[model samples]
Target: MTPRIHGGTDALGPARWDFSSNANACGPCPLALQAVQQADATRYPDPSYTRLRAALADLHGVEAARVLPAASASEAIQRLTAWRARAGDRRVWTPPHAYGDYAHAASAWGLERVAGPALAQLVWLCDPGSPLGQGESGAAVQAALEGDARTGVLDCAYAPLRLRGASALDPAQRDCVWQLWSPNKALGLTGVRAAYAIAPRGSEAAVAALQALAPSWPIGAHGQALLLAWAQPAVQDWVAASRTTLAAWAQDLRALLARHGWACAPSDTAFGCARPPRPLDATALRARGVKLRDATSFGLQGWWRLSAQQPPALAALDEALQEQEREAVR
Candidate 1:
């Protein structure tokens, strides 16, 4: 079994200067947060999620029947993988560097990892992809959608957080593939585990299969509240404004790392991968309450994926690095 490698809070709890997660630094959106807090936890959410589905569909301008709720993006990956596997899918293709769950779920469901999209039954695509914070190539996107029988899942987790570059798949093309969305990261409320997918226009049978596999009331009250708030105009405005702040901070992060001789790669989003002048002492940084995501798990060994943080957190990172340098000299 492949171990799941992730960012954000862990066994030791969250780091004070946590650049490990790509969540919106300017969030949690006040409206969204208020909604989540006010959720009616005492009672169960509507089992059918009729209103939630309608609201999300309205936001994306899709039919309610095409909206499939998920417990989280990871859960959706597993469920989708299982759906493909049960349908006799034997081969899967994922981005060279992507969220670990894509491969992890594939492995769990006995799907073989293929080298290319042309040879796979299920294909995973992420725009402003994780770790690298890069978009998929046009060729890859076209290939993933080529086969009528193939299952293509486009992870839109980072779409809302994208500071630059448009998605590889346009609106029309998106309707041909499953578009998975997890708004928690965009709202700066990563603690909420709720996501949904816009099923391909003609995937009624596939959506039914995925839904049947899901447990009743997959999304709890708090998650329902988050999703409802996500569709609001005010919440969308907050997310849009956050991008400006994140873009400036991203520049500060790049300059800070560059000054220390670290080579930073350009990313379309607020986070990017960078290789330090020397090997990083992750434990030392942790002790200083500074945490960064190791890119090794994402296949970029020797590099770290750091998200743009506020000024104070960035300063904490700088001080921690300088302290490490001083200790190395001693």
Candidate 2:
């Protein structure tokens, strides 16, 4: 199978200005950072993850039984897909532009992609979606919720980092679908791998099924620490404050790209897609200590996903793009 592509730090090492991964530009939150730093790696975490599960459950106002832990959001996707496949689900549906892992996991489990949610046995939804960073349509979400699909998971990875707009799903609707959260992004601790899911109301059987498929000790010491920090009131407060900074940075980045004749797509979150006046040489950019996510992997050819960053990073990008333009004109 072909390797899946992702953003953030990559094989080329970190970039000077990385508009690739959509982690909160204003994070890693100090509180969460301190928690991870202090996590003791000498012992195994509680195998049952009782305390961690309870903390996540309390954060979502759900019962502990409804909270399912995973090594990361990507692992959650794969495990959930594997469980659904084992349960006889043979088809999946996904948004037009979504995180690639959804399709990758589905394909790994022999699930074929169908054009619509109504026709698939499993469906994936990303609110304030990846690449585009836009909210999914209400009609589509309703269709997925009310459809005959055996399972539906809404990736809320970017929800806490949303710079504008409310979730498309109401509380009632939200209760009907699985909600997956990866706090590493919100805490600006993407290096830490940890995520959890709130199974839909009355999904005890499904949760149990997924648990059976998961390996023992899905989360590690540091992962546990990061998640516990994520549930704290002070950490959440920091996340909320970070959004204001991100909103301003996103605006500045968008304006900067627009000035360079890039077509910026509308987004409700801290990142979005933009198409430059000319094709970008990703390798060349990387060599210049700048990197951008090629949107082709997210199903958008000739477009790029740009994550909001501080002014210094944005300025570096500006210089890089200018240099590229100068060379192209030569």
Candidate number with greatest TM-score: 1
Leading candidate by lDDT: 1
Residue 74 lDDT (model 1): 94
Candidate lDDT (C-alpha), each: 0.94, 0.89
For candidate 1, give the lDDT of residue 54.
96
Q: What is the lDDT of candidate 1?
A: 0.94
> Candidate 2, which ten residues in sequence have the lowest lDDT sum?
142-151
- Deviation from native of the Cα of residue 20 in model 2, angstroms: 0.8
Give the least accurate 10-residue stretch of model 1, judged by summed lDDT. Answer: 143-152
lDDT, residue 200, model 2: 94
Shift of residue 273 alpha carbon in model 1, Å:
0.6
Which regions of candidate 2 fall more than 4 Å away from where they truly are?
147-149
